[model samples]
Structure formats: C-alpha cells, structure tokens
Target: MNPLAKLDQLDLEPAAKTEVAALIQSLIEQAERDAKIIQAKDAVINAKDVKIAALTHELAYYKRIRFSTKSEALAPLQRDVFEETWNTDISAIEAEVEQLQDDQPCATVARPKRLRAGRQPLPPHLPRIEHRHEPEFCTCGQCGKDLVKIGEDISEQLDVEPAKFFVHRHIRPQYACRACETITAAPIPPAVIDGGMAAVGLLTWMLIGKFLDHLPLYRLEQIAARDGVSLSRSTLADWVGRLGVALQPLAERLAWHLRQRSSLHADETPVPQLDPGNGKTKKAYLWAYRSNDLQPGPKIIIFDYQAGRSGRHAQQFLQDWQGHLVVDDYGGYKALFAATRAHPETQYILESCIELACWAHARRKFFDLFQTSQSPVAQEALNRIAELYTNEAEGRDMTADARQRLRIEKSLPVLTNLHDWLQQTRLTAAPNSATAKAIDYSLKRWAALMRYAETGDLPIDNNPVENSIRPIALGKKNWLFAGSERAGQRAAVIQTLLGTAKLNGLDPAAWLKDTLEKLPAWPNNRIDELLPFAAPD
Candidate 1:
C-alpha cells in the first residue's frame, strides 16, 4: 500500500523493473534526509530566537537602569562605582545584537539612536599652547595674484600631554685639599629610593600614575616611551616595590589611627592574582576600613590585601581594637561580632565587636525587588527607609550630640514602625519568597540597624568605606590583576596613603611628592607628622 512499494508491481522487463525500484528507494531516502535537514534548521532558528530575546531583555534592563531616574536610588558615589560597567555592558550587548542580526536571513530592526549633545567649548581655564595652521599660498586657488588676508576662522581642540619628562641636573663641584691632595664632593641628598636616578617629582608621577590613575607599570613605561624617555617596566616595578617599602610605615600608622576611633566603616572587594602553577588567576581580597566621617577626626582609609576572604583576615587587621563597625551583611564579619572570640594574632579572648548594619545595603534589597517585580511591599519598605534617610540627611551637618537628638526625635519612631511592619509582612509572605528573605535580612539585623539612630557619632551605613574602595574596584579593570601577592600588598599600601590624602581634600600628587621628599630623612618617631592629614583639629 506504500508509494515506494508500488514500484515493485510496475510491468516491465526484469532489469528495467529493478532499476525503477532502486531509483524510487533512492528518492525516498533523499526526501527523508531533506526532512531531517529542515527540522534541524528549525531548531537552530528557535535557539537563535531564544538567544536574541535574552540579549534584548538584558540590553533593555541595563538601559533602563542606566537611563531611568531611579538609577539615583544609590548615593552618587555608589552609583559612580558601576557607571562605567553599565556603559560597557550596554555597548557590548548592542554590538552582539548587531552581529546576530547580520547573521539572520530575515530583516532586523535597528536599535534606536541615542541623542547626543553638540560639541561644547573647551574649558577656558586650561592653558592653551596654540598651533596655528596657515595656507601654503596666500593667493586664492583660481587667481594668480596675491590676496590680502581677511578675518581668520578659529577653532579649539582639547589636547593633553601624557607626561612631560624633564631632567633635574644636580651638579656637585669637587673640592680638593692643597696639602694632602684629598678630593671630596657634596654628599648625595637623601631620597625615598637611595642612589636612584628618579627625582621625587618623577617618583610621585610614577606612583600616582600607577596606583591612583590605575596605569600599570608597562603602561607607564609606554607613556614615558612616547616622550622619548627610556623607562623599562622592570625599573618601574622596582620603584613601586621600594616606594611601597618606604610608605608601609605610613599605612600602618593610618591603621593605628583608624583603630583609635570609636566607630568605623569596613568593606572588602575581590581582586585577581596571577597563579603560575595553574596558569590562571585566583581571587584575592582588598579589605577597606575607614574612619567615620561624622566623627570629629581626620578621615583615613586603610587597605589590607589578603589571599582569601577569611574572617581571620579581618580579625588579624582589627587585632584587639574594639569599636562599632558599620559593615554589610557579609558572613565573614559575623565572627567579629561574637561575644567572645580568640584574637586573630594573640589568640587571647576579647570583647565583642559592636555591629552597626548598613542601611544602604538593606535598602538595596528592596530596591532590587521593586525594580524587578514592582511589588507594593518593596515600595512601602523603600518609603519607610527613605524616611529614615531623610531625617539623617537633615542632621548630616549637625554636631554629634545634636544629630543624636535629631535622630531620637525623628528616626527612632520610623525605625520602630518599619521593624513592626517587616515582622507583619514576613508572616504573610511565603517562607521561600525573595520578599521573605529580604524581610528576614532586616529583621535579623534590627538591633544593629537601630544602633546608628541612637548615636549620631556612628555612621548610618558603610558607604564611606565602600566609596573609598570604589576606586580600587575601577582600577582593577584597567590594570587587570596583580602579578603576585607582593604586588597586591604593595598596591594596598600606596592606595591607603593616596586614598586618605584624597579623602582629606589634599591633592594626592602634591601630597605624595611632598611625602616622598621628606620620608627618607624623616625619623621613625616623628612619622605621624608626615601623614596625609595634618594634625587633627
């Protein structure tokens, strides 16, 4: 009854019948192969559609986050941290979408073009070194006779010098004794790097360029090469090492001062370290600790580089210091809050570390949920939290005692109501739902969250330290990763000094240059005088 089977019944000679059946079978096989090919093509098309849909969704999400007014949910400094990443991701997604569209057989919709601002005048404050371009011939092209010049068209372009390398020749004349024929020259002045060719100014430039500006040593070398200066990466690396050694005491002193404060902010970010054995990179941590901005003292930021995010690393850095520590909900810092725990170094029992939970972090949980689902519960929670922040914002410039009074008058009731609301909300929410998890986070840390309301001397959140760490996070993307543990630690040292300088409203380059010049001849006992901040008011 099959179509192919009918070939066998056809009336013909024996050889003709055999040839007809064989041809029909071959045709059936070819048809089956064609059907299989069509199915595979459909599957491929479906997969591509799914991929494009996902990419489109991601692109839209990033665009909304980047362009929407709600992007200001985080503090300016916090938002600044991820601005570059969002821009890069958006560009990458757009490029991938374009590529995929080109591959498709069907017509594709192009992305909407972003409106761009017209070119603006360059800053008038910049010292312009002008280069005038004049025509080779004063006469018009069509005319043989010379022509007088009229008003010239003028335009300005912003230009920069990467590094203007210069020489500082320190000439020391030799003096000879007439009788003994003894010759002597002035002794070389002390330098951060002894007997080094680099001046303090040059050292400062390299240091700031590599650490603060996030330029790698090789990049610095390349920059110098463009100026016809021969600076090998090896030499740059050696200078960084020596500079770290010279600046270590200052960073350590900063840590000492930071611990002396009654309260502080702490956080950590991951850094990559090269592993030669596996020929890949491994994770490291840069733990950042900062003095509370509200307290009456000089601002300080200390960076501690560790191979892992063990609680022990924090314990080691904190030592016997005890104070209110404003931090995120990282489990690593939980050990620090235990009533009794062995010291990281001495193994001696110590008092518990008072915890002050970060409101910004708690707010982020609800913020993320609201963004994703537009849940009324998240909105209500955000409103309550925003009320608390509003009170804090009003009292930001107030004295410690005045701020505390303001919080007691304003923030305490809101916090109490918010806690009650969260408890009630949790009862109705599914135990495994994201809403429940978010509620639990706040409820579990309620006491720590309320601590800041009781004392204005303590910070409301850990944004200060996180803000300080943001530069380091941004820097890693540029330099990629540390070549070794020593390199990471050295970076931490320089970052501490430079970051503190910036926090205290000092120009980092100028401060670093001055510090380098004084460090060599500076006495150990008087090192505090060389801190980024002048003596605390």
Candidate 2:
C-alpha cells in the first residue's frame, strides 16, 4: 500500500508530459521499419527478373552451341552450285590419286547452257500464195475488161476467248387415271419426272454443263441441240431459277456449317454485280471460305456474295464463329478478331497461312540476283530456306503438331538466325537499293511469310482457292456480271453443288441429275444428307 501511494504521487503534471513524448517517438520508429520492408520487397522482384533473363540467355546459348556446328546459319556463306564449268586438265593427276586412294574416277564436267540475249526470232515464214490470176486487158472506153490483182496485204492477229459449257434437259411425260385417281404413268426412275419439265439427267447435265464447266446458257442451248436435247436458253434460265429456290435452304445451311468449324481458310475476289437502277454495273465481292478434313477437321467450303466490300461483310459472315480463321492481312478482319473473344485465346486465323511461307516464293524474289555480286544475302537466305523445305518435303505428311514440333526443334534456329541476319542488313541498305529492297521485304512479312514450316497440312499457297475462282473470273470475262441479284444467287447455289461434287470425286452431271429429281421427295429430316458433298456416291 505504501509503494502504490508513492508511485501515484510521482505521476504529477510535468511527469505525465515526458511520458506522452516517449510514446509518440516509439510509434514513429515503427513507421520507419515498415518502409524498409516495402523497399526490400521491390528489390526481391527486381532480382528475380534479372535471374530469369540470365537463365533464358544461358539456355539459348547452350542450345545453339550443342548443335554440331558452331554457327547454325541457314547455310554456308558461299554458294554451292557452279554458275559455270571451269574444268581443270587434271585428269592424269585425278587418275593417279584415285589409284592410290582406291577412289572412284573423276567425272567429266560439262558447261551449262548460255542464254542468248537478243531479240526473239521473227515469225517462221511468209505466207506462200502464188496469186495465179494476173491482170488482163483494161477497159479503154465503155468496154468490159479484166483487172490485175492488187498488191498483197498482210494482217496478223491472235484471238482469245473466255473459258465456257452447255445444258441438256430431257423432258418426259406422265399420265394419271382419273377413274381411280391413284395410278399414274411416270418417267424412267432417274429421268426428269417432276414438274413436267427437263428430265433428271438433262437437268443434271445442265447444272454441270453451266456451273462446273462454266458454260453460258446460250452456249448450252446450242450444245444441247447438237446432243439431241432441245433446251432453250430462257427455259434453262427459268429452270435454274427454280433450282436456286429449291437449294437455297441447303446453300444457306452449307454456309452456316462452314463457318462453325474451328479453323478455316478465307479468300475474296471482285465480282461485278449488275445494276438494276441504271444500265451501268458496279463491282461487288464474292467471298470464299474453305475447311479441310485432312488436318484440323472435316472439310467444308463455301462462297458468299455481297453488294459491297465493307468490313461489315466479313463481320456478318464471321459474326458468331469463333476459333482459328485463316485470312490474309486485310483490315476487314480486325473487327472480327475483336468480337470472337475466345477463351484460352488460340492464334487468330491471321496466323493460319504460316505453313505456306516457303523457299519457293522467297527464292523467286532473289532468282535474278543469284549469280550476281549482290547475291550473298539472297543466296544465303535461299540455301537456308532450302533446308527448311528439304525438311518439309521429307516430313510433309506428318501431323501439323508433329511437323511444328520438329520445326521448333530443328529448323527454328536456322530461321531465327536468318531473320536476325536479314534484319541487321536491312538497316544499312538503301531505300531504292535492290538488295536492300529484297532484304526489307523478307524482313517485313518474314514471320507471317514463313508460317509454312509450322505444318505440312496447310496449302503451299492459296492456289486451290485461286483455281476454284478461275471459272468465275472467266465467266466475268464473257458474261461480265449476273443479269440480276437473283441470277447471282442462283450462280452461287449451282456452283456450290457442282464444285462440291467435283471435290468429292463424283461426276457432277450425274450427281446433279440424281439430286434434282430426287431432292423433292427427299425426307425433310435428311436434307443435309442430300447435299452433293454429303450425299452417298
């Protein structure tokens, strides 16, 4: 009790003020300690990043050095193939060396053919005509006389026509009994028995004759008469109109199904759409979408037509589609990529043509420069590019993933080094300089350009689609454009069936004939099955 009273008495007004100051000083010290802790945390993050970079560098170094050669450049700096033969007269020394070493005899070298740089030869020969009739007596007064042949004249021309086919319709009749109203006479099982028009076989021929073969209706009518089928251009057009209506549902479904696939290739070409308002015409666009069953999934291809080339056209086709969609570097697809919003974010179709970037295209650019003094870079790139192709040609049939893995393991380093070398050279070259220009091109689209090494399954080029569109391009040359939007739509449907039939290894005319005659009676639930592509042989 005495100690507690003494302690309470010591806490007077002056003592209380001293004690409060000490408490405030301790709180300030704790704040300083927390600041040091935060600084240490940042330092740790910085140290970790440094280590990561160092390890990455070390790994790359080991991988390159582990290879057989010190430098994994695409190829050696020197060119291998001889530009010209300079055979030394060392045959005696070669035989002695071969005898001593038990080696094979030295082979003789022959010089390569030299191109004669000159104007190409003129036409083979002049026309050989004697012109037998000479001049007779001339008229003096009002008397009849003969005249001499005038001086010979020569005119030369080369003519070309667009690729063109014919439609044949065989119309068969049917009779029904009104007494029973049940029994009816019909055409042959596969003949054109519906709607009392062209026979089944004729319509089929017409479908292929015009669509697959790219023949105009007028030409088809002419051919049909020769073939003993009396089909008129107008009647063919009318039947085509009906055919379009009948197949619209299938065509629409085909387009939808093609878009649903995960990975697809796309291309577009200018289409001339006829003008109804004025007699004038405007250039529209027909877009193509193709899918293959070989690598990624089941194959499907479709062509889409539109009034204009707006980005909206692309958006409309790809609106709900998601996943890999291969396309050229067109700005129209930007909105499409943004909208798909796929989870796990696989590469966009923009990356699909990666496998087609090969030595062929790259090498073609430098062909003229190969033997010139400005050839080291071009030749090096070519040789290294050749290595990648050599690998591809050897392993092209392998799966895309396997092929990609091999590239990453083997060819990837060479590509990387080649790309790096090109990049460095590009900076020192002139803007208009030829070598500089070549290097710049290789550097710019280099990555997108060389995607071919990724897999063998992809096309070497966009040639298939190009080949398919060639018919339409030819048609454009002759017919110029569709007579109406309805005609354009009809072209799309007939082309779809004919093209699909061709793709599926069937005779288009036969398939078309069978499909048209039987499609009306085909079950609604099995509509998709009746499609040319999906139909059984």
Which of the numbered candidates is closest to the native, going by highest lDDT?
Answer: 1
lDDT of 1 by residue, 1-537 (tens): 676577667778889888877888899899999999989877777777777778889999998988884644666655776787898999898888777767866523444464568989888878988788888987889977887877888888777865678898999999999999999999888988888999998999999888898888888888888888999988888888998998999999999999999888889999999999999999999999999899888999999999999989999999877889988999999988985877899999876699999998898889888988999999999999999989988998899999999999999999999999999999999978989988988998999999999887888888888878888877888998888999899899999999999999998998998888888999899988999995555
- Cα-lDDT of candidate 2: 0.61
lDDT of each: 0.87, 0.61
User: Highest TM-score, which number?
Assistant: 1
TM-scores of the models, in the given order?
0.73, 0.57
For residues 235-351, what per-residue lDDT tens digits would candidate 2 score against the true structure?
Answer: 888877877788777777777777666556667888887797988888888887777443653355577777777778877776666655555546676566555333456644342
436 in model 2: Cα distance from truth in Å?
5.0
The candidate 1 region of ten consecutive residues with least summed lDDT is: 106-115
lDDT for 4 in candidate 1 is: 58
Which portions of model 1 show Cα errors greater than 4 Å? Answer: 1-67, 72-160, 341-350, 534-537
